[model samples]
Target: MADFLNNLRTFVRVVEAGSFTAVANESDCTPGQVSRAVTSLEEELQALVLHRTTRHLSVTDVGTRFYERAKVILADIDSATDEARNATESPVGRIRVHSSPGLAYSEVATALASYQASFPAVSVELKIEQSMPGLVEEGYDLSVVSATQLPDSAYISQALGAAYSVLVSSADYIARHGLPRKLTDLADHALLQLESPVSAADEWHLQSADDTHLWTITRTPFRVNTPDALRAALFAGVGIGTLPTYTVADDLASGALVRVLPQYHLRPFTVFAVYPSRRYLDAKVRTLLEHLRATLSPALANAMEIVETFTGDATAPPASPPKRVAGTARKRPAKRK
Candidate 1:
């Protein structure tokens, strides 16, 4: 019976490929062997599965129904084999992870380093892309994403943390343009804008305890599609820009960029670790998620501090301001009440 079932599987493969030669090539056997297997399978089932001509193979209605059943059966057998192997093995397998390029460089890369160190048996393949790929169709075990909310899908999402974005400029630019003490003051300065996926003119919206404010400031003097490029531009004193705190922690610490509007804050964005249904959850995927959760908690705390240093409090003793240089200072008349 086992031999018969094996031969039936080979017949199913040949039927699916639509040619004995193709199935033979895939199964690493001769076309004659595939023909024999199909013949044997048909004898056992007492039904003709294919109508063969000189040029093509056509499936009968019964063959079509049998093919459908065989496909499901083959899938179940594959799943069973995988589950059984996982029960004994140390969860060793290749895990493919997809993430946004900016987050991949900033946070995901660090998290993966620790994860790989801890799980020596598992291998990770990370791809940074802007488009959301289908997890199952693409055969990715996991993905990390930052978005306003969880996407509606069958995939399971675990919240890693919240990302806070803030408007920032180089200390030199702020010194040259004068600080924007209020939302209205933003119009007077060169505002570096991030182009959205949907449109070019989307404005940065900010909120505070008392009220919400929208600024239609000028677009970035030089626009780039990526967050890393925007960060570089801000560092180079291109213009004031908005970005996630995690992407600019080191720069903020070094005073390369200073946060604007310390009084009002922008809305927070959510980060999620998403994966397909847990049925085929590989060991690498589980370990990666664990590592990320453990590592990102403190990292997120530090990121919040960057925001706090700018928008929350500056009670610490002030450091000496930079020396005035060309295009580094703005002359403005005193405001009248």
Candidate 2:
């Protein structure tokens, strides 16, 4: 019975990941072993579930039906197990979390450490990448994603907090290139662009109290997809680029990186904790979300406060908060430092 359940879980993972090797890596096993688990299940059921070839693997009609049922069965079993264990046991299990490189470095990585310290039995594996991965397909228990608008999906998203980006350049870069005196002068300078979910690649819409300006860069001598890489390039005096204030808060405070046009910043966005099956959230996932809200909420608020401080508007009354579109901020103050 236990072996059958293990096989069922492995089969579900293989179907979602679309690769036996991927499931094997998650399980810390070999591909052949994972393939054998599927074979064993097929033999037990006396039916073919998948079409296999050296270069192609597809679900059969029967496999698709079986996959759906098996997924529900596993989810129910997990829900039941968690419910039974919750009353007496501390949350104990391995949690796989996916996050973008910037947020992982600036926030989630540290939060996970404190979470584990409190729940000593819970172990975590963090995967940092630029793209969002399927929570179930990639075997991630949760994903901490920062974006202006989250792509439509079935996963449940809990807003961790709001965050925003700002234009920044190293002091040395300013010394070498000379700061832009006005928006038009940016055209003559080395404008670094960091590609992120919330930022446009070739242009930026910088917002101030009075109005918004569309500043477009004609040439990007250096363009990067990750925020950290962009930050490094700025440190190297590659060009002036925008960064999440939280990622560069220390740098700005230490005068390592100086904010450009402190009053004008990119639009604000929300950081979300996304996961599968809101109804059956495992105790571990639920507690982790709560911990994040407590820790990251203040951190993000502090980031916004930092922006206000440097912009020399700390004493002014806060502007009207922007209206949310699709449960996310459309345009607001930068929340993450």
TM-score of each prediction? 0.68, 0.68
Candidate 1 colliding pairs, count? 0
Residue 155's lDDT in candidate 2 = 90
Clashes, model 2: 2
- Highest lDDT against the true fold, candidate: 2
Per-residue CA lDDT of candidate 2, range 23-55, in tens? 989999999999999999999999999888998
Q: Which digits, one per residue and each the tens of the lDDT, describe model 1 over residues 194-251?
A: 6533223357778777888776654447766677778778777777777776675555
Please report, as a residue range, the 10-residue window in candidate 2 with the lowest summed lDDT. 322-331
Off by over 4 Å in 1: 1-84, 87-89, 196-201, 312-337
TM-score for candidate 2, please give it.
0.68
